[model samples]
Target: MITMQYRIVLPADYDMAIIRKRIAERGHLTDDFPRLAFKAYLYADRTAAYAKDRENLYAPFYLWRDTEGMNAFLGGAGFAGVIDSFGRPVVNTWSVWHAQVATDLSIATYATREIAPIAHHIALGELRDTEHARVQEDVERGALAAVTAFDPTHWTLLRFRLWRNVVEVADKNIDVYQVGHISQPSAKHDS
Candidate 1:
């Protein structure tokens, strides 16, 4: 599996309702898209009651079965619409080492992503195993969904998780967002 995300920082005064409406109206377009595992429509409002930062942003995260699906979406009109509205964004991608989802993914209301750099001396194989185990433990406990991926290009590891409720995280490197919608294209295969 592959994980991808692109963030677009909006103006401080930007109205976030526009993004909400956009998700409500078009988020389902990918519901049954081929080779797509899931798409999480996520956004953050600086003015929201639970916001931890003062920067508004529209960022969507995706899990794909392979590069074929990822490439198809990027070449499609849906992506074109995004470029038309927000200009082109620098998309970040990682090779997934582990992914687990609960039976009810629709209950996910919040999402968190943490990116950390891997030290030069660390064994990549061992690091991947450790992160995979951690994610399994998290999902077994109560996490709605969890994924661990790494980008060798930058030697960065990404830890992403979905929760059914709001969470208070103090880590400066972690980004939290409210989930507007989730498109599980391959719902039958989710586990």
Candidate 2:
């Protein structure tokens, strides 16, 4: 599977209601999209007390069944619409090692993402195993969904999770976003 995200940082004075309305209107277009696992429509409000900094943005995260699905979405009008609205964005993708979502994912209203560098000399097998285990532990601790993946180009590991409430992480680099909606074609899965 693959994980993808594109973050579009808006102006400090940008109104987030525009993003919320867009999601309310168009987020469901991909509800039954082929080969899609889920799409987390996420955004951050700079004015919110929970915000790490004063930077408003609309960043959507996606989990695809394969490259074919990823390519199809990128080439489709849905992506074109994004380009028209926000201009082109630097889309980031990672090869997923693990992904799992609870049966009742609708209650997930918040999401978190952490990106950490992978050591060049580290044992990849061991690293993958360790990250996979961590994801399992997070699920057991009440995460509604979790994904562990890595980008070979950047040698960075990405840990993403969905939750029912806002969660604070000790890692200062972690990004927290409010989930506007979730588009899950498969609906439920574990892997």
Candidate 3:
């Protein structure tokens, strides 16, 4: 599977309600979209979380069934609509490793996103092992309801999570998407 996302940094004074409304109205347009795995429409207010100097961001995360699915979405109307509203977004993708979501996704009302540079000299096995362990630990702590870890290229690594409550961690803070409104892969299996 493939994971994709891009962010739009809103001007500091820009009203976020506009973006929130956009998500409310059009975020789920891809619900049953062809080859879609899942899409999470996310928003973050820099003043609310993260370094005070950060800008508000609207970022949507996706897990595609395959490249066909990824290509279709990017070239499809949904993406076009996004560009019309937010301008062109720099799309990023990752090879997914483990994705776990609890049955009640709606409860995932909070989220955290962390992007960090990859350590080029690190052994692949070590990196994978460390990431797997960290994700598992987050789940065990009840801090995360859904999590997806990626083997990143454009970025060293990206970690995103749907959370049950406020996590003390300083990662990017995001508004949780409503359940049923979000979409996920139809079938699940080990990768």
Candidate 4:
């Protein structure tokens, strides 16, 4: 599967209610969309934890079954609607490994992006296995509702988590989360 993210960082004083309303009104429009695995409508307030140095952001993450699905959305009216509402967005893509979802994710209130900088000397297999293990750990123990890992291959070792709250282990880490509410699918999906 292909993973995609488009982030729009808003000004310091930008009203976040606009974003909330947008998510509420249109977050599920992509449900059952062709070749779409899922979309997480994520946001972090300017004052949220780990957001001290960042602007309020609307960063929606997507998992597409293939590139065709991604292209369809990006090259269609859906993308045009986004541009009209929030200006041009820079899209980022990554080759994903395993994206595991543990039952319903609608209960999530926070999502975390945990990254480890991978050096050129490290084997890709080693890094992949490590992230896979981490996902299994939380998913098996019911600590996380969903987890996805991917590699962009030149920057950072990346993984994402959808949780009901900030896990205590992440309290001291540089973790980002959806400040108030999360817009995830309510139905359970096969992992």
| Backbone clash numbers for all candidates listed | 0, 0, 4, 0
State candidate 1's TM-score. Answer: 0.95
Q: Tens digits of per-residue lDDT for model 1 on 114-143? A: 999999999999998999899988887678
Q: Which run of 10 residues does model 2 get worst, by summed lDDT?
A: 182-191
For each candidate, give its TM-score against the true structure: 0.95, 0.95, 0.82, 0.83
**Cα lDDT tens digits for candidate 2, 1-191:** 99999999999999899999999999999888889888999999998866867489899999999999999999999999999999999999999999888766778899999999999899989999999999999999889999999999999999999999998776778889999989887664432
C-alpha local distance difference test of each model? 0.90, 0.91, 0.68, 0.71
Ranking by lDDT: 2, 1, 4, 3
- Per-residue accuracy of model 4 over 71-179 as CA lDDT, tens digit each: 9999988789999988888887777777786456667777776656678797878878877887788777564544455555655665777777665443444457573
Record all residue pairs in model 3 with backbone atoms less than 3 Å apart, i.e. clashing.
37-185, 106-179, 109-176, 118-156
User: How do these models rank on TM-score, best leading?
Assistant: 2, 1, 4, 3
Worst 10 residues of 1 by lDDT: 182-191
Residues 1-191, candidate 3, lDDT per residue (tens digit)? 77788878789988878877887788557756778766777777766643345777787888777899899888888889889987898998888766666654545656667666767798767776788887888788785344555554554576777776656664344333322235544522221
Q: After superposition, how far is residue 164 of candidate 4 from its true place, in Å?
A: 1.4
Regions more than 4 Å wrong, model 2: 188-191
Pick by lDDT: 3 or 4, better one: 4
CA shift of 40, model 3, Å: 1.0
* lDDT agreement of model 2 with the native: 0.91
Q: Per-residue error at 70 for model 4, in Å? A: 1.2
RMSD of 1: 1.7
Best by lDDT: 2
